[model samples]
Target chain A: MTTVLIVDDQPLQRYGFRMLLDSVPGTEVVGEAAHGAEAVRMAAQMRPDVVLMDVRMPGMDGIEATRRIVAAGDRSRVLVLTTFDIDEYVYAALRAGASGFLLKDARPEELLAGIRAVAAGDAVIAPTLTRRLLQEFARLVPPAADGSAQDSRLASLTEREREILVAIGKGWSNSEIAGHFVLAESTVKTHVGRVLSKIEARDRIQAVIFAYDHGLARPHAG
Target chain B: MTTVLIVDDQPLQRYGFRMLLDSVPGTEVVGEAAHGAEAVRMAAQMRPDVVLMDVRMPGMDGIEATRRIVAAGDRSRVLVLTTFDIDEYVYAALRAGASGFLLKDARPEELLAGIRAVAAGDAVIAPTLTRRLLQEFARLVPPAADGSAQDSRLASLTEREREILVAIGKGWSNSEIAGHFVLAESTVKTHVGRVLSKIEARDRIQAVIFAYDHGLARPHAG
Candidate 1:
C-alpha cells in the first residue's frame, strides 16, 4: 500500500483528503497534521511515500517546512496541495524541493493521480499552468556577455555536437535525439558524452542549464 | 564606436531607435532590415555587435532566423525587439539563443540599458514575465524511475551529502549552505565534493540538475 499523510490547518479538509485517499487500492492515510511543523515531524517519523501539503501554514509555512524536511533527508515526496494554483508560494515550494503541484479543487482522480505520479517519480504540473510558465520564461533573459560565453565554452563544440546538445537541453534523450537526427543511438551517445566532457558538464541537466545560462537554448520550444 | 543593426519593419520605428541608440556613447546604427531573412544576412555580413530583432516578419520569422544566425556562429548578439512581452515567439527566440528581450515601447533609456546589458553579457528580461515563468516551472516533477538515469545513481551519496545536493539545486553555494547549517565553509565544501563524486556528477551544475530531476530545485528563481 502507498502510505500518505495529509497536512493542513483545517481538520475537516484533512479528513476529506483522507477519505478520498484511503479509498484507493493499496493506499493508506498513515497520519495527519494541522500545521507545517507537525507535517515535517510526521513525515520524518512515518516515512510515508507521499505528503499532501497545504501551501499556507502557521509558523513554518509549507515552503520552509518542505525545505527543512527535505534537508533533513526525509525520503517522502512532498506534493504542494492548495486552493491557489499560480501563487509565488507554489513556485517557492518547488525551490524547496516539492515533488508535485496540485490544486485542491482538482477532481478526485487527478488528486490521487498526482500522489501516484509523484510516488512514481513522474512530475505532475497542472497543464493549464505549463504553457503560461514557459511563455513567461521566454521573457527572462540570461546574463548576457558581449558574446564571449558562446565562443569560449559552447561554440567550441562541433556543429553536429551542438545540435545534440540543444536537443538534450530541450529535454530529449539520446535515443530520441537519434530519431530526430537520423543518427545511430551509439553516435548520439558519443556526441552527448563528448558534450559532457568538452563543456565540462556533468550530465544532461547541466547541459540544459548551460544552454539556458549561456543563451544557447531557450526553455520554450516552438 | 559600438555599431548596431536595427531589424524591424517600420521605418519610423527604426528612425526612432536610431535616434536613441545613436545618442548613447559608443553606439551607432550600421544597418537595418525589414524582414527576418534579410536581418540574418545583414547581421552575418555587417558583423555588428548587436542585432535588434523583431519577432514577427513576413517570411523566415525572427525565431527561425535567429536560429540560423546563431547556428552559423556569428558574432552579433540578437536582442529580440518585440511588441508582445510574453508571446510564444519569445520562447522560440530564447531556444534559438537570442541574447536579450526588449519591449518595443520601453523607455528610450530602458531600451539603451537593454542593449548595453546584453552587449556586456548580462541578460535583461521583463520582471512581470519572470514571475509568471517561475510559477509555470514549479510544476515539473522528476521522473519516478529510470533504470539508468541520475536518480538511481543518487543513492550513493550520504544523507548529509544529499541535503547539500538539494541545497545546490536551489542555487546555494558553499558559504550560504555553511551559514544555513552553522557548519564551516570547509565542511560544506567537503560535503559538496563528496556528493559530487558519489553521484558521479561532473561538477556542481550536474549536481544541481540531478537535484531538479529528482524533484528537488525550482525551475527558475526570481
Candidate 2:
C-alpha cells in the first residue's frame, strides 16, 4: 500500500484528502499535518511513501519543507499540492525535490494516481507541461560559464558512452536504450555506470542533468 | 475547422496521416509535403493551423524546418512527430519553437487530441515525461557568465517586482501570482509588465527562462 502524509493548513482540506485516500485500495493515509514544519517532522517520523504537500503553508511553506525532507534522505517522495497548476509553488516544489504535484481541485482518482506514480519512482507531471515549465526555465539559462571545462570532461567519453548519455538525457529506460542500440542490457548498464563515473554524476538522473547543463544534450529548437 | 499541413518523407506515413486526419471532423488536411524544405515553404504559403511535422526527414530535418516555420512569424503551430518520445529531436523541436510533439506509435485518438491541444495553444507532452526531460536538461545548465550583469537588471526592480519575477520563472500564471501576493490582478499585470521590460524579457516564458538562467530561480537541492 502507498502510505501518504497529507500536509495542508486547512483542516477541511486535510480531512477531505484523508477521507478520499483512506477509501482507496492499495493506499493508506499514514498521517496528516497542518503546516510545512509539522509535515517535515511527521515525514521523518512516519517515513511515509508519499507526502501530499501543500505549497502555501502557514509556518515554513511547502518548498522549504520539501527541501528539508528530501535532504533528510528518506525514501518518501513529495507530491506537492498547489492552488493552480501554473503556480510558482509547483515550480519551487519541483526544484525542492518534489516528485510531482497535483491541483487541489483534481479528482480523487487523479490524486490517487499521482500519489501512486510518485511512489513508483516516476515523475508525475505530464511531458507537455513539464516541457513548458522546463523550457521557460531553460530559456533564462545561459550557456554554463564553465561549459568549456565541463565539455573537456566529456571529451574522455567514447562515442558509444556519449551516445548512452544522450539516451539517458532523453529519459530512455535502460532496456529501451539497449534495444534501440542493439546492445546487451548488461552492456548498457556497464556503459551507464562508466558514464556516471566519468561525468562524476550521482546517478542516471544526474547524468542526464549534466548532459543538458553542459549542452551535450539540448531541447530541440523550433 | 482546423487546417493542417502533413509533412513526412515517407509516402505511406504521409498517406496514413492524411487518411486519419481527413476522416476526423473539424480537422482539414490542407496540404502535404514530402520533405522539410517543402514543408517550410508550404507552412509559409498555406499558413495552416497546425503542421504535423515528421522529425527525421532526409533533406532538411524537422528541427530546422520547425525553426524556420516559427522564425517566419506565421500563426501555424508545429506539432512534431518522432519515432521515440524521448528522442533529443523532440527537445530540439521544442527549442525550435514547435508547440509540442507525439510519438509515431500514438493511438489515433491521442493524435487527434494532441493536434487539438496544440491548435488550442497548449503543449501536448505528458507532464511526467516533461519533468524528467526538463529536469535533466536543467541540471546540466551552468550559471550564466553574464549573470551578474543580467542580475543588475533585476536589481532595478522593487522587492515586489522581484518576487513576481521569481513567480513567473516558476511558471506561475498572472492570476495565480496575483492571488498569491494578495494583490489586485490589475496591479499584478502592471508588475508583470514592468518585470518583463526591466528584465528585457520578450514575454512571460522568456522572463521565466531568464529567472533560471540568471539563478533567480533554482530547483531545490536534496
TM-scores vs. true structure, each candidate:
0.39, 0.59
- Taking the candidates in order, what DockQ does each have? 0.05, 0.08
**What is the lDDT for B89 in model 1?**
58
The candidate that achieves the highest lDDT relative to the unseen native structure: 2
Q: Write the per-residue lDDT of candidate 2 for residues A26-143, one digit (tens) a residue.
A: 9899898999889989999999999998888788888889889988999889888788666455556666778886677776776787788789887676433544664664353433
Interface RMSD of every predicted model, in angstroms: 12.9, 14.4
Q: Give lDDT tens digits, candidate 1, residues B18-127.
A: 88887778888999899888988888898888788888778877877777777777667778878877546555676577776667877787688677766765555543
Best by DockQ: 2
Global Cα RMSD, each model: 16.1, 16.5
Candidate 1 lDDT score relative to the true structure: 0.72
Question: Model 2 over residues B1-222: C-alpha lDDT tens digits?
Answer: 899999999999999999999897999999999999999999999999999999888989888898899989888998988886754665567667778767888789879988997888777664445556546543544333221123568679899888998887665777888889999999999999999899887667556556655666554311
Candidate 2 chain A, poorest ten consecutive residues by summed lDDT: A140-149
Cα misplacement distance, residue A183 of candidate 2 (Å): 43
